[model samples]
Target chain A: MEKRITFKGVWLPLALIAPQIVITAVFFFYPAGQAIWQSLFIPDPFGLSMTYVGLGNFEFLLSDPFYRASFVTTAIFSTLVTVVSMGVALFLAVLADRLIKGSGTYRTLLIWPYAVAPAVAGVLWLFMFNTRVGVITWYLGQLGYDWNHVLNENEAMGLVVVASAWGRISYNFLFFLAGLQAIPRSVIEAAAIDGARFWTRFRTIVFPLLSPITFFLLVVNVVYAFFETFGVIHTITSGGPQQATTILVYKVYSDGFVGQDLGSSAAQSVILLALVALLTVIQFKFIERRVHY
Target chain B: MVEKRGAGLWLTHVGMIIGVAFIFFPIWLAFVASTVEQQAIVRPPMPLLPGDKLVENYTRALTSGVNAPVATMLFNSAIMATGIAVGKIIISLLSAFAIVYFRFPGRQIFFWLIFVTLMLPVEVRIVPTYEVAANFGMLNSYSGLILPLIASATATFLFRQFFMTVPSELAEAARVDGARPMRFFFDILLPMSRTNIAALFVILFIFGWNQYLWPLLITTDPSMNTIVMGIKQMFPSGDDTADWPVIMATSLLAMIPPVIVVISMQRLFVRGLVDSEK
Candidate 1:
């Protein structure tokens, strides 16, 4: 049924699309262009002089040990957090799928964490892990373990990873649960009749079926671990205990806003953007083929 | 076979119980902490039981500083979420309608554009977005906070996916009866898409309300802050101890709207997912 495009149809779409293009141009494209432009020049805050430093910002980043360390921390943090969180979320989703009663209650309660704003979640967790007054700190003290996130680099990284994982599990669980429920019970019954064990059934049948959902979560979780932990890192550790938690996005924030090094900050942002884009391209090009859907 | 099936179900139940407990523990701790006094909160052995200071905490959190009046912050958050919800739905509906119904010149390109934007997180473009808002003199204004985010790629994508499922015969019948495109969309399509709209609304509302980085960058004035910003400010710097009770109180308060929406629309979400699959 080939429908002819009418005057009203054409005009209405143009009218509706105008605002989106305008807003995207102003807010997304223009600012992105400016950030790229600013990355090339060092702007003196005190002297109010802008000087061209072709590749100097990137060169400075490569030369500086602190900036180099930040890349390592971000890579380790994002990879480890994404794997661990997705693993736990998948486990929880499969478990929840088999529940015959109170499934809705469990789903609602489990997803409650996603409702807590990231900033507030950071504050809440930081309060719990505080050396003097934190509940977790007190519990650790009872076991004769000196647990201070402020002083211990390993503990600080652990705290950030755990907080990031906990904060995001709900969203992953939602998708995984949906994926799990979509699998047919008849297929499971047939697999069981063929003498397959629970583990065998899941690994051979369910896991393969849930691959697309898992892949989607993997991409989201990776992006989140890279960028979304800014508020958490800022509030909890301030990239402290020897800058152990200063990931790329946080570095960009500190360099640009707090440290007033706009050029360096812009350079860091470009690096972050490039890293994310590469991951996205890889996921779409290679990994997406393996997705069952 | 029956006995083995029962055992497997029991094991799954146990795993789910533990999983549910792990998820809820932090929220439970937050609620307990909110009820305690500041002194008790900072003690070496932190208080686990609910304290008698919930009211005092609420009072202090409500009247802390000149920056965010509790009522005003709530109002601002509400306005931002509502505006985004209405704006996103309208734009997404119109755009989705155009892509699904009208065979335009750049329809496929437009569709791909929205999908590409889905992968482009705000973190990448935030610096420039800040500059854009500044240029337009939208800093510290609601327009800055709401307008930039109103055209969500996720919403547009979701609507396009859902709209594709609607039978073209319905639109054909409407057009045959002398109904124009806009009239066909309004009269024939919208009523049928109430469920998808409701689900998308809840999702978009939650996202809009939870926005932090962009809003923080653009809104400098304390009075213009959202609930998340208000909570962040409650954490005092330097040697000054943060008041835990007030922080927890405000945190719990900030969570209420999203919680309410999620609970109320839980059935709708599940139903919509099922229907969309079909």
Candidate 2:
């Protein structure tokens, strides 16, 4: 049966695959390979001389305090954003699951922010945090608390996290809500009959059943924090107040695009790629089994 | 017990209402701020109601300096999104049909390769893509903005997954009717997969419209900027007194298309999520 398949039928798939393969090779594979290549060589901006420096770029990154801080910042940012967004999403999803009325309306309203483009979300948050005109700033000022994210490091980080969490909660909520709805009501009734309270029922019944959704969301939210939050950071502070909020990807963007240091930027990207790949592998290996699906 | 449960439900609804308000307030603020004067915006105790400056702010944002015209940006975004959506749907359908219906060597490997690309985001290869675009002289061109993103791995993967759920008997029936593969794909499979296609279209359109970094990077000319990039350019560096109302107004304007698309396609959007599970 397999041998009977002919070239006449295969041509369309082959043709379809051709464009994808070529695009990936040129845009995805080639660029990634070149980034690795550039990482090994130091390029002089004036003379355009590229000299090979084995592990020198890596050494420079390791030795630099700013680069070191980026690793810590990236870790904290990704983890906090993922954990908080997932928690809020799960909380809302559970609440949404139990509601008898207005559930669909609530779901739609909740997911509205997810529909807003990240750029728009960033801009909106920027305005909301604007010192003079920002609604949040005005509200904080009424309480005699001066909140200026532009100059303070901790405040800047806090604002970014809040904005990131707001933008992220929608996507996470959708997934968790779906996951919650997938759970059979009969299962919850069984627990209810067994005299399980809300917390007890959630712990023993709902939470484990929602594990796969949670795991999937965990990985996705982490990756999103690493890659998607660049626009927010760029728009909000431009990594300002002396590079306080510059995560790894933003650092890569600034170095390569703004600073015009392609070699170091490429090197930084390589590090980021490795870090992401490691996290991905770890999630698959360790967390995959824990996921119910 | 039933009365207590009803009370709990009421409390839950009340809490969710607050949550909804929190989610919506920023957007509402943007809309309200767009209508207010700059001085009024900075005034203590911000106005919760719509202001009189809506027309003036909208006018200034539309007529702003060096920014791509709002009409042209919308046109460009629509053209790019349509091209990408149509191209992706076609490519995905063909490839998914092949993976699902055909008995081919190395089929699983090809499928896996596409799936792996989903995890590897465009950010990783952005620098090299810039160079590739420059090499092809696509910089500052619409082709440059739309071409690289045309063949999406995620779309292909999604279609393949959806097609797998489609019964094999249908394809076999088509072949029994003397239908060639391409003919069956175009006439049978394509039409049957309308829901999946619609879902993919909404997803891709939103993603393409929301795209910022790549478009900003490739399109050096201000004229080529998309709506998102145009909003970004509104903030001038080293300028103390930036135009707040114009910025808010433009950002609000930029959001209208995607918001419209999402509201209209809400059913398809929810269906897409359900389909992903299969």
DockQ of each: 0.48, 0.50
Q: What tens digits encode model 1's per-residue C-alpha lDDT throughout A69-147?
A: 9989998998888987788888988777777677777888887877777776787788778887888888888899989
List per-prediction Cα lDDT, in the order shown.
0.77, 0.78
Stretches of candidate 2 off by over 4 Å are A1-12, A279-293, B1-5, B63-66, B103-113
> Highest TM-score among the candidates is held by which one?
2
* B187-233 per-residue lDDT for model 2 (tens digits): 87788888888987887888788887888798878778888777778
True contacts kept of each: 0.45, 0.45
Docking class of 1: acceptable
TM-score of chain A of each: 0.91, 0.92
- Cα deviation at B44, candidate 2, in Å, is 3.5
Query: How close to the true structure is residue B27 of candidate 1, measured as C-alpha lDDT?
Result: 77
* lDDT tens readout by residue for model 2, A1-293: 12233334456666667666667677777788999999998888783599899889989989999999988888888888888778887888878888866788898788777777777888999888887667888888888989899888888888787788888888788888888888888888887788888899899888999877777777778888998888788788888767888888888888888888888888987887787777668666754475453
Clashing pairs in 2: none
Interface RMSD of each: 3.3, 3.4
Off by over 4 Å in 1: A1-9, A46-49, A282-293, B1-11, B65-67, B103-115, B270-278
Instruction: Provide the TM-score, chain A, model 1.
Output: 0.91
